[model samples]
Target: MSDNVSDGVSSFADLGLGPELLNALSGLGYEEPTPIQREAIPPLLEGRDLIGQAATGTGKTAAFALPLLQGLSSDEGRTGPAALILVPTRELAVQVSQAFHRYGRGLGVRVVPIYGGQPIGWQMKALERGVDVVVATPGRALDHIGRGTLRPQEIKAVVLDEADEMLDMGFAEDIEEILRETPDDRRTVLFSATLPPRIKGLTGRYLRDPVQIQIGREEAPPGEAPLVRQNAYVVARAHKPAALGRLLDVEAPTAAIVFCRTREEVDQLTETLNGRGYRAEALHGGMSQDQRDRVMGRLRGGTAELLIATDVAARGLDVEQLTHVVNYNVPSAPESYVHRIGRVGRAGREGVAITLAEPREHRMLKTIERVTKQRITVEKVPTVADLRARRLELTRAALQESLMEDDLSRFLAVVEPLTEEFDVMEVALAAVKMAYESSGAAADEEEIPQIAPKAADREGRDRRGAGARRDRRGGTPAQGMTRLFIGLGRSAAVRPQDLVGAIAGESKLSGRDIGAIEIADRFSLVEVPESAAEQVIKALRRTTIKGRKPTIRRERDTTGRRPR
Candidate 1:
C-alpha cells in the first residue's frame, strides 16, 4: 500500500466535487477535506477500484461516497441500484445511508440500509420503490438477493466498508456470494483499519489492479497535543465500577461511550452509572433494533451523556459530540482495542481513551501497547481529594464564564442586601458553595483500592514469550478457563474461525479470549474464560452456527471414565 499525499490541495472544491456536493459540505460546516478524502476521491472518481487502509473517523465515508454519488446516472429511467455498500453492522448501514442522503439530497438520490435486526419488509418496500444505492450487511444482503428482492445485475460500483470486521463476523462467505452475483465489471473499493492475510486474499481475488492507499494516524504539528490522549488505570475487578465513576467525574466529558465485554456487564454498569446520577444507556446484540435506535437518539439529542455498550453493538457508530471512550476492562485483543479507541479523536478534534485494567490484565495492556505502537500511560485512580478539587475547579470556571458572558444585573438586589448584612467575601463563598452543591459536586467518599501490576503474571508472560501457552493436545484449558462442547463440528463444516467469530460477534469476548479448539467428526470443543462461559453458551444457543443451531453447553468431566 502507498502512503501518498495530494500536494497543494486543501478544499473539497480542489478535489473536483460537483456544486451540489460542495454546497452540502459547506452547509454541514466542513471547511476542508480530510487526508483520506483528498487522496481517494480523485482516483475513485475516475472509476478506478481502490484499497484504502485507514482507521475509523478518517472521513473515509465521504471519500468513497462522493465519487459514487457523482458517478450516478443522471437518467431518471434507471431501475435497480447502481451502487452497493456493504458494512459490518446495522448502525453503520444507517449512518452511511444518512450520509448518502445528506450529500446527494440535491440530486434526489435514494438510499436504503438492510440488516437483520430491522424488519425486512421495510427494506423490500424501499427496494421496490427503486433506490440509487443500497447499504447492507452481508448476510442480509445475501438473503435479499436469494429472495429475488435485490437485483445486482446493473450494479456499477461496490464498496466494502470495514472489510476486516465483516470477515471477523464470519460474513466472508456471504460477502463473496453477494459480490459474485454483481456484475463482474463493477468498480470495487475496500476500506479497513488493518490488512491481514485474509483481507489480502480477498483483494487479490476481487479488486482488479486497485489503487492502494494507506493513511496512518496523523502526527501533531510540533509542540501541540496529539489528536488522542491514551491512558489507563489499574483497579481490581470489584472496584471497576467505582473507578469508572471516579474517572468520569474527573473527566466531565460532554458525551462518552463506556465499552463493556458482555450484555450482563453492560446492563449492570448502566444501572450503576445511572444511579450515580449519570444519564447512561446500554446497547448490546440482545437489544432489538428499535431499542438500539432509541438509545442512539437519546445520546445524540443530549438527553443521555454516556452509552455503555458491547463491541458488536457499538460498531459503525459515529457520534460527533463524543469526547471520551472508557474501557470498562482491557480489550481482549489489540485490534479490538484499536477499533474501540478510534471512535474518538476524529476530524482533528482532541479526545481521550481510558482503560481500567485489573492487575492480571496488565500484560494484555502491554500487548496492546506493542501492537498499536503507542504508550498507554498507567495513571493512578483519581482520589477523593482529586475529585473535590476538579469539581471546585469546574465551579470556578462556570462562575468566571457567567461573570464574563451572562447578565448578572438582575441579581444585584440580592448581592447588595447580602453585602450590607455580611462581608462580600463570605457572601461570595456561600454562593460558590451553593453552586457546587447544586452541580452535584459531592464526590464518592469510598476510595477505589489502587492495584499494582502483578509480578507473577509478568513473570509468567516473560517465560512464555508473546503467545498464549497451550497444552500438547491444544485442548487443555488454561487457568480459570473452561472447555465448551458444541455438537456441530467438522461434519457440519464448522471451523475454528467460525467458532471464534460466532462467539466474538455474539458476546463481548474477543477472538483472543477464545483459547484452543479441537474439531472432531461430529463435535467441537473450545475453551473460554470460566467467568464468560454462561454468556457464551447463551449467545451461541440464541444464534445459529453455519446455519445450524448446535447443542452448546459446558463440557462434562470425563477424564476417568470411558464412553458408555
Candidate 2:
C-alpha cells in the first residue's frame, strides 16, 4: 500500500470495500474518507498488521472497521466472532459496536458489546448464538475468555482502539493475556494518540512487519487559521457562572459539553445552568449505567442542549451536532486539554473550545498552548451590552431564516389588515417585537465585571509575596482569610448587614467567620476565610442581594495595601 493509492482513493467504494458496506456508508451520509481513514484503509484491507497514530474523532474506528467487515464471512457456518475490538472504557465499547452494526447492517452483521456494567447472562447468550464482531473492554473480555465463553482463537482480526489509554489505565497484563489466547497469525491493528514506548513495545511483541502510519496533528497552514477556534476568558472564580451564562447567550451553541473537575461540580453547575434557563444534564461516575444512558439519549435526541460532565464520565462520547467544548476550569494536564478539545472540530467541522481561567491558572493555559502547538486567544467576557447585541443578532438571524424557509402565508391576512389600518413599518415593528420577546431574550442583566491580565513579573511577585506573608504571620494572611470584592455598594442600598445576611443565608459560612466589611459607593470589600470563598461565591450567585446578582470576586490589588 502506497501513499499514492491512499491519496487517489476518494470514497469508501474506491477503497475496495463491498457493496453492502458502501451502501451503509451512503445511508449514514458519509461521502468521503477522513485523513486517517484515507491513509490507514488501504494497508488494512491487504491483511497487514498496522500501527496507526491517530487521535479520537479522526474516523479511525471506521478506517479499521470497514476493512474488518469486508473480510468477514456472511455465511451461517461462521461459529464465533471473527473480529474483536478492545477499548479502554465501556462507553467506547458501546460506540464501536454501534458503528460496526451500522456499517455492516446490510450484510446482517451480528455485533455485541461486552462490558462489566451490562449483564453477563445476556453476553453469554449472545456469544452462544454466535457473533461476527465483539467490542469489549479488556477486563470484561478477559473474564469471558477465562470462563470459556469468548474464544479468542476464532478471531481473525483484532483492534486495540485507544491503545495508549488502555495502557495508561493499567490494562497491559490483561491485554497481553487476551492476545496470548488469540492466534499468532491474526491480523492486529492498533490505534493510539501517542506512540509512547510502552505502545511501541506492545507492537514489537505482537505485530510482525507492521505498516506504521502516523497521522500528524492538523495544523493551520502558514497565514491561515486553524479549524477549531480556541479562546479563553480570565474571570474571577466568583463570577464564572455568570460569565459562562453570558458566553452561552452570545455563542448559542446548538449542543455543548461542559467539563467539570468533580461530580459535585457537575451537579452544581448543571443545576445553576438549568436555573438560568438552559436545558442541562449532569453526568458523573456516581450515576447508574441506566441513568447515564438516559442522559446520553436526551443529549442525542436534542432535548438537552448542554451536558455537564466530569472528565472520566465523558470518555468515548461522540456527538455529531456538538459545536462547543467548555472547560469549567483549566485541565490538570496538557494531554487532558488535547482530549477535551478533540471532541469538537471533528470531520472538518468548525467548533469552539472555551476555557474559563482564573488569574493564577493563566500560566497553565500557556503551557497547554505550547504543548498542543496551537494558539488560544484570551478573550474578554461579554458584558451586558454585548449580551444585548448578541440577543438582537440572534433574533435577526431567526427572522432571516424564517423568511427564507418558513411558510408565512397563513399570517399574511393579519399583517395585511394591520398594514391597512396603520403604516406597514408599524405593523412590522410590532411583529418584530413579538418575535424578540418569544425568543427568550433577557429583559435586563447587570454588566459583568472584567479583570485585567496581570503582568508576568507581577504575577511572580504576587506568589512570592503570598508565601512571605504566610511565613511572617506564621500562617496565611488574615489567618487564612481572603478579601472578596462585591460589585454592589451603598448606591444600591446595600449594607453590611445585607451582605452578612446574604452570605450566611446562601453559603455555609456564618456571620462569625466573616471578617471586616468596607462599603464604598461603587463597590464593597469583605473578608472571608480562604477555604470558604468558592462555596460563598457559588451560593451568592444562586441567590440575589437587594434583588440583583452583583459581580463577586476575590480582591486583587497590585498596589501595596494591607487588609483592614
Number of colliding residue pairs in each model: 0, 0
lDDT assessment of candidate 2: 0.80
Mind giving the per-residue lDDT tens digits that candidate 2 earns over 1-564?
235557577788778888888889999999998878888888888889999987677889998999888888444577888989999888899889988989989888889999988999999999999889999999999999989999988988889998987887789999999899999999999998777789999999999899888775565445333556787889999989989998887766667999999999999999999998999999999999999999999998878989999988897788877878999999988877877898887765556799999989999988998887776767678777776665564455445435544699999878888877999988878888887777666643857678776565345334442212211111123657787767776568675568878998888886556665555445666778889998987887888889988877666443533223
Q: Considering only N, C-alpha and C atoms within 3 Å, which residue pairs clash in candidate 2? A: none
**In angstroms, what RMSD does candidate 1 have relative to the true structure?**
21.6
Please report the candidate that would top TM-score against the real structure: 1
The CA lDDT of each predicted structure is: 0.83, 0.80
Off by over 4 Å in 1: 3-5, 26-29, 74-77, 395-443, 452-564
lDDT of 2 at 30: 96
After superposition, the stretches of candidate 2 with alpha carbons farther than 4 Å from their true spots are: 1-7, 23-29, 74-78, 106-108, 216-225, 394-446, 453-564
Q: Estimate each model's TM-score.
A: 0.74, 0.71
TM-score, predicted candidate 1 vs. hidden true structure: 0.74
Error of 2 at 314 (Å): 0.6
